[model samples]
Target: MHRGTNLPAVGGYNQALILDVIRRSGEGASRVELAEKTGLSAQTLSNVSRRLLDEGLIRESGKMVTGPGKPRTILRLEPEARFAVGVHLDPTVITYVVLDLEGHVVAHSRTRTPVGTKPEETIRRLTVSVNAIIETSGIDATRILGIGIAAPGPLDAEGGQVFNPPLMTEWHNVPLGASLAASTGLPVFVEKDVTAAVAAEQWMGALGDLKNSLFFYYGTGVGAGLVVDGAVVRGASSNSGDIGHLIVDPDGPLCRCGKRGCLGDSVAPVSLVLEAIEAGLVSAPTGELDSVTVDNDFTRLLSLADEGNGHAVVIVERAARRIARGVLAIVSILDVDRVVFGGPFWDRASRAYLGVVPGAVADDPALMMTHPIRFEQSKLGADVAAIGAGCLVLDRVLSPKPTDLLI
Candidate 1:
């Protein structure tokens, strides 16, 4: 809402670098602390902090307990001064959430992706929705950092483009980030929806300060978001946790990703739905459960299972078995403390996997049991990914990296 001071020379210690450190330090650092952490001189830290403080991105909190001399006024983020937009784009629909610095949603909006429609046209509608959200939220343009879109992927994260994800075929090479950035006049970051969820977990969810933990992301399709030592691991192209491709049965049905026996085909929602169809239960096709007239969201799936629909129970149980297998494989390789599951697919999956996941882990009789791994359901619930992606912006402005000194 107000200017603090001017920025450092563009090439010198910049806002991105300075903000990165403060974020990692929990969003507030004294001039002395920043200088020490970043290896920048006191004068440079002073200049940078001054610029940030004046910009209202950060604020001085009462005082810190300095040893003997003057009590130091502690510095912290002015979380309300800025905000981020998190867009969860699935084939089903687009969900937009606006998060303030603390990752709380200030406002929200939703729209359908218009199945089989042109990608450009869909994004145009998304842009309009973004505009509408900004207007409805009553947030200032300058206070908005950027939009983060969490889409189903096979993504080109650096190029900010979407590759041909199965459900979103019309979105081939769509420049989701650049287009939204251009239209919204704010920077844009694109991440796989599952990965975004994992990032959120690492930054703000149950993971807390753990160094290594795997997030078993159960959604329309299954995947994972890996956080190693506080960093969101990005495999060469920022799509590391495409574990849906893990082939649990090499002789199974062909996966949309073109691998027969891959996990997505073996355990994803459609597989469960098909199982219902085969048993004379579901007579319809698997579209977005919302788009269909079946009254299925996840609530319905669980309710059906609870009522003992023979086919539904069998399929859901089978899917959970496959998912448990995947989780076991992930833990064996990663050795994380706990495996946390969350997503649109989580409810029924909880019913399906809850009883079996721990058994699968324990059955890994191959591994030692001196300390067994634990499992958890996401407490953040359905909105974890959207909130986490939006938190990325605050992270960019708060967390610091070693590269700040080197780069």
Candidate 2:
């Protein structure tokens, strides 16, 4: 529970703090209960609750006769009081979502990322798509707080730019955040895709209850999102989760980074598809493989492995082992007991990877942690990073930090 201050000047902080507690309370909370939980005086709680009710952020649901004197009215969060927009810029697809204050996705859309297009052209498309989705959702523009974007990293987050990501060759030092903000006319925040994934898991998924965990993101590229001491870790440059370069297999595959068997090159969807092509399990495309082509081929490879194809099984098993090895190193370093798996490609590979990874990590002689590790697949599905991006807007507006009390 977040404690509230009696100081008069920080009323805004108190209001946000109270609103946060009310939102988290599923059944709603009474003024007396809130005061008890937040360590606020009855008068202070009453003032904050009145402000929230006046702003339409919270409502008096009904009267609850709990044990004592008069009936206590339940104060519940008004979930639709505000909205947020989330956009995920993937190498293959761009996802957009509109989220209500309660973190529910009210609307969503997906578009294939423009291949061989200039960043300026792509941003124009993004602007058009964002406007279209907002209009289609029937949401009042005034109710929207802001837009948040999740993108591939090596981001200049402080400067609101996206440095050239490995998969996105055309996007070099792109001012994505500023450009989107200028076009959309809303406050915009940019976050690394994996970091946003973990943030979404923490905000809306079961991971919120855990103190420490790792979100192993398996997308076009492989990365990890970290949660330590119940907080998402965004390192110095807001590009913390870059596990792709971890050397998992020394003799496996040559990476663009001039290294052999890097975790990303060995287990990425494209790599798996290429391996399948080499092994005669998949037909190689006649022309250069675009994102869509690689996606389709990767799906085919997974389907073949699922159908008991011996060669496909070997490839998947090997990839799973390499992923496990990389995960082991990370888990050893972080000492987190919980590991979550999700991303665009995670669903297709979950059955195979899940079957191998948990046991492999547990049985490894070099495993560092004595406690049993728990693995879970994200319930947010493929659009998790997008949803998380929206949550960033909501979190910024509603969640109260101790720093807010710093005077």
Model number with the top lDDT = 2
Most TM-score-accurate candidate? 2
Please give the lDDT score for candidate 1: 0.72
Q: By summed lDDT, which 10 consecutive residues of candidate 2 come out lowest?
A: 203-212
Backbone clash pairs for candidate 2 read none
Tens digits of per-residue lDDT, candidate 1, 1-407, equal 11122334442335656665555567477776766656666676677678888888778887777799777666776768889988888676577889987677888776766877898888888899988898899998788888888888799877889988887667778888888888778888888888888888776645466467788877667778887766677788888888878877677678767778788778766665555656766565555444433225344555677788776676667666677778778877777767788876675568567877677667765555366677888776767677667876666655543354452
lDDT of 2 by residue, 300-348 (tens): 9999999999999999999999999999999999999999999999998
TM-score of each model, paired residue for residue = 0.85, 0.97
| Local distance difference test, each candidate | 0.72, 0.91
Deviation (Å) of 107 in candidate 2: 0.8
How many Å off is the CA of 358 in candidate 2? 1.1
